[model samples]
Target: MCGIVGLYLKKPELEDQLGQLFSPMLIGMSERGPDSAGIALYGDPVADGRLKLTLQHPDMDYDWDGVKKALETQSGAAVSVDACDNHRTFDVQGDEETLSQWAEANLPGVTIMSLGQRIVILKEMGTPQEIVDRFDLTNVKGGHAVGHTRMATESAVTTAGSHPFSTGQDLCLVHNGSLSNHNRLREVIERRSSIRFQTENDTEVAAGYLTWKLREGMDLDSALEAALEDLDGFYTFAIGTADGFAALRDPIACKPAVLAETDDWVAMASEFRSLAHLPGVENAKVWEPEPAKIYTWGRAA
Candidate 1:
């Protein structure tokens, strides 16, 4: 079992609502996936400052001090690795892509899951506040975001086995449920796209199929529809990018999704309790979406 929660808001009247809202939503679901957790925030460019880089090494011989020093040379700022547990957080200033690339190359078996304007991900096999304190999310702000606390049912509880699997084209997907046809689909897609698969987890296959379709010239809606026909089994997923964000449940609707929408924002989760934390949303109208339906909620902005 895994937990997924996300919000797609229209142009907000206030600027800092993104952080205030997402932070609480994530904190609420921390108990769901105590094994590994993360959040993917989306926003425009911010002025250069320190960047938070989180790391997780399976053992104590991680050489974090040397790695931090080397990354400082590459990042041109002081670098530090937080707690030496299975998880750690970092702070960087330059380009997300540049730093992520460097981290990808140097930090083998590492993941640069998120790089939003105000927040980067600091999730690992631990509790919510533990990870949040590592990176200080109480102050970060953004337009939209998604957070996941993962309970690894199939894969080993490693850092890479976290949520918000990066789809590699600005789009990242977090899912709840199993894809029965994932093996066949993965075989076909990898042969066609020639893109490497990172983990044995089935979640990445959906992202791969969507990414492959997008690369092969398919729009998001069409891709979702195609996924409905091509992929078998049940899933409810959230996909986010800088341009827009949306969520979908499988046609069979074996999984659950409850959502609340207003002129300003749309929030969804597998259950009603998940929406209890949104600011000013205590009295907001919350309803469940119909089964076998494709509901798209983008930034109405």
Candidate 2:
């Protein structure tokens, strides 16, 4: 009921083409999901002691420069703002938590998409091509990226309800299929973890679950291993982080998933057609990810 695509470049020379390649893959899946689309890009890290925050505003005339000045004055550090469409990426030289607090008090009607050292997530209620064109995704450069086009089976079509949910810093998840026990799991997570749920969407719960488990000292692979046991329902998840990307499927593996890996990159999609046009794809190793197995790769791993 959704489309998922992820790309991790193994060749450093292809880093600059990350977005250029990924944009088409995402667009290819538009028929699967036309309600909403999103992408999480893991680009170069911000300068040490700095972080990036992506904020979206509904108002076209929003004053980005004024907001940046206010943030800089309040945080007592330099803040740079880059505007693209309705979203603004702020490179802030201060504590992420402190800046979030300042925004909550000062910026009215602004939605914070993500804050991290290496990731920027942009998603909205539109077709995949529309969303990408609005954000100039083809020009974006990153080490790795994951994207989703949603059909809206679980939640209403709203910007906040879009996929690629981010519950932890630099972490995002795009899911296909529904979770059968999400309500129960959501209740359990809320009672047991400090991480709070921001939306009723089950995908957000999945992202929160990963964040909670990682905070509990579980490595990414181990956390995904645990997810297969605790979480129910059919799903194909493509998760992104600061350094890498990972994919997981339910034990039953009802949802579709295809992976193509070449010496230069690793790519995954809900279907193989999305990957057919990638460079060296014909020579790449192709297969369906096994049930209950986790596939992960990145610069760090």
Candidate 3:
């Protein structure tokens, strides 16, 4: 069992409270998933020509300044760093592929968590409250966020095995069930695209699949529709994108998920209790997401 929660704010005024509101929703699911916790926040887009790369290292006081200087000198990219706990968000005014390659070859202990104009992912092996406190999640401001708490039935409880896996820019997924065909799917994806799997976790495979589909020219909703036909397993998924949030359930719909919407926001969680404390939730329209249906909310919608 796992806990997944997402909140998408419809009003820009609420962006400042994103972290304060989202933290509790994540913590409420601690009983369902006490192994590890993660969250992907979307907002604060960099300039049109720039990208934000969030990187994680095991050391709380990693040598981020040295890394930044090396990156700027070698890659010729103007980089600004925002260090937070064990993670750092680099605003890069350069090529994403080149920067990623440089990091892979030079940064020995660093892991790229997420790369995009609007997404910053933070996760680690701990209770949801611990992660929140470590990252000071209550002070984070964003337009939307998706989080997960894992029970570790299939993989080790390492930070790399945590949910909210990012396989594409500004795209991440948190899952509530297992995929039976993940190994086969992983092989197919690796052989077909430039994307590579970073971990053995099935949720990573699912995220990679969606990334591949998006690269194939399908929009988010269509890609999710295709997922219903392609991905086999009993699962519930909450997908985070640069501009939107989405939820899906497999045909069996065995895993629990609830979606609630108010005039100002849209939220999804593995259980209603995760949504119980959100602002104005008492009057929000609430229901269980239907089996195999794609439900989406976003800035454009």
Candidate 4:
């Protein structure tokens, strides 16, 4: 089982509260996934320049050493790396062009999937405080976004197996449940594509499939609809992107994803308890999405 949560706020004041609210909420759902946790924030358009990247390793700080030099040299932005017990943290101050360009030219062998002034993604393979301390996450600001605590079922526990897997330049996905036909889908995608598969995990495979179809220029809506049709399994997914957010369960909507929505914000989790913070969010009016149904939340503007 995995935990997935998201918040889309219409009110700027409500949005300001998201970063503070997010870590705590994610902390609440830690039981759903313990292998790793992540958060992707999309601040309102027209904000200051800050894109932070955090990395953790047992004996070395590869994520910091490598990504920092790349961003500074390639993008002409100033970036710095800090050290936590097991991870290295850093922040880069630049525009979308600087961050996106550097990540692309430098962050090879990894998914530099999402990049934009509208989004900031931070995650780690431990508790929320671990993530915050190692990455200096709280300093990286944005209007709204997502974070995850992962449970590595079919994959090894590492940053590679974390959630909110970014697909498009502005879209990242977090999933629960298993895709029974992952082997076949992986084979099909590998044989007929330029996309590369990096890990043995089903989540990465899922991201690859989505990325492949999207590269063909298919919109996320149609690509996801096709993914639902072509891929068979018992799964629930939360996809976060710059333009908006989406979540869906399988044909039966078997895996649960309960949600709370107000004119100012939208939040969902594996259960109602995860969204209990909403003002009038009682035991009632909180429900899961219908089978095969896709629910989306996007930029308020």
Candidate 5:
């Protein structure tokens, strides 16, 4: 089992409190998943023609300053660094290909969590509260965010096995429950799509599947609908994208999921307690998400 929480702010006024509001929800679900935890936050977009790269080094004392200078020199792009614990986010002004080449040649032993315009994902092998504290998550400000606490069922308890796996640009997923046919599906995906997965976790495969579909021009809603048919499992997923937040449940609906929405925000979690502290939640429209259905909210919608 795992714990998943997501908050999508409809009111621009609450953007500044995105992390403040999300922190407790993640902590509330600590008992559900104590193995590892992570969060995907959608902050303001970087300047056009530039991309953001979120990286983490296992070494706590890694020299970020030297690495930053090296990246700037290698990519020939201005880079700004934001450090949190062992994690650093670099806003790099260059094309994706150039940055990829530079990273391959220069930044060995670093894990690239996510690369995109509006999303930053930070996760590690630690308790939910530890992750929150390590990243100063309580002070983070964003438009929307998705978080997860994982009790490992299939993979080893390591930073790489953590939840909120990212496959597409600005897209990530946090999942509860297991995918029974994941291994087979992983083979199928590897044979057909250009996408490559870096983890053995089923959640990562699910994220990659969605990335493949999105690359094929399917929108989030359609990609989820396809997932219901193609994937076999009892799972609840909270997916975050550059401009949208979505939740999906398998047809069995065996996993727990509750959604609460008000004029100001839309929130979902594995249980009601995770969302108990949101402002105006007492008056929110709360319900259990239907099985095999996709629920979505976006800035554009």
Candidate 6:
């Protein structure tokens, strides 16, 4: 079992408080998932032609500036690196594919967490509290965010096996429950698209499936509607994109999910406990997300 949480701010005035409000919601799931945790935050977008790549290395003291220099020299792109804990967000004015390829081939210990115009993903093998503290999540400002606290049953408890898997630009997915046909689905997606699986995690395959659907020109809601028919699983998914947040449950609705929306914001979690401490939750419209129903919020919708 795992815990998934998401928050989308409807008020621009609340953007600065996004992280402050989201921290407790994620930490509340520590009991449900003590193995690993991850978060995807949709913050201010970079320029239209630029993208941000959040990369992680095992060594906290790794020379990210040196890596930035190397990347700049190689790609001839004006790259800027922001270091936080063991992660670095590299803003690059270059092609995403080329930068990804260069990092894979040249940066030995670096792993690209997520690359997009508006999203930054940070994850590691630790409890939700530990991750939140380490990343200084309380200071992260964003319009929307989705997080996962993983209790690894389908894959080993490694950083790479953590949730909030990203298989597309500005998109990430966190899931509760397992996918029975993930192995077969993974093979099909790999053959059809340029996407590749990084670990033997079922959640990653679910993410890849969404990436494939979105690449096929389906909007977030349409893609999730199609997921009910194509993906076989007992799961609840909280998906975060550049400007949108969405939630979906399998047709059987075996995995638990709760959604609450106030006039100011919207939130979803694997359990309501995660939403209990949010501001104005008492007056929020709260309910269980129905089976196979796609719920979405944001400008992208």
Q: How much lDDT does each candidate structure score?
A: 0.69, 0.87, 0.89, 0.68, 0.88, 0.89
Residues 1-301 of candidate 5 have per-residue lDDT tens digits of 8999999988788889998999999999999999899999999999998888888889998988888898788768778988878889998887655665577567788877888898899998888898888888999998999999999998889898897888656889899999989999999999998677778888888988998898889878888889998888879999998887889999889999999999988899999999999988889999999998888888421
Relative to the true structure, candidate 6 reaches a TM of: 0.97
Which parts of model 4 are misplaced by more than 4 Å?
A: 44-72, 75-114, 128-140, 280-285, 299-301
In model 3, where is the ten-residue run with the lowest total lDDT? Answer: 292-301
lDDT of candidate model 5 versus the reference: 0.88
Q: Give the Å error, residue 122, model 6.
A: 0.2
Candidate 6 on 1-301: residue-level lDDT in tens? 8999999999989999999999988998998799999999998999887889889999878888888898789867788877778999988877678878888888887888998898899999999999999999999898999999998888899998897888566889999999899999999999999888888989898898988998889878888887888888789999997787888899899899999999999999999999999999999999999988888888654
For all predicted structures, in order, the TM-scores are 0.77, 0.95, 0.97, 0.79, 0.95, 0.97
Ranking by lDDT: 3, 6, 5, 2, 1, 4
Which number leads on lDDT? Answer: 3
Residue-level error in angstroms, candidate 6, position 230: 2.0
Q: Between candidates 4 and 5, which one is better according to TM-score?
A: 5
lDDT of 4 at 24: 58
Best of the two (1, 2) by TM-score? 2
Q: Report the C-alpha displacement of residue 41, candidate 5, in angstroms.
A: 0.6
Native-structure RMSD, model 4: 4.2
Total clashes, candidate 4?
12
State residue 72's C-alpha deviation in candidate 4, in Å. 4.4
Tell me how many clashing residue pairs each candidate has: 12, 0, 0, 12, 0, 0
Q: CA shift at 136, candidate 4, in angstroms?
A: 5.7
lDDT for model 6, on a 0 to 1 scale?
0.89
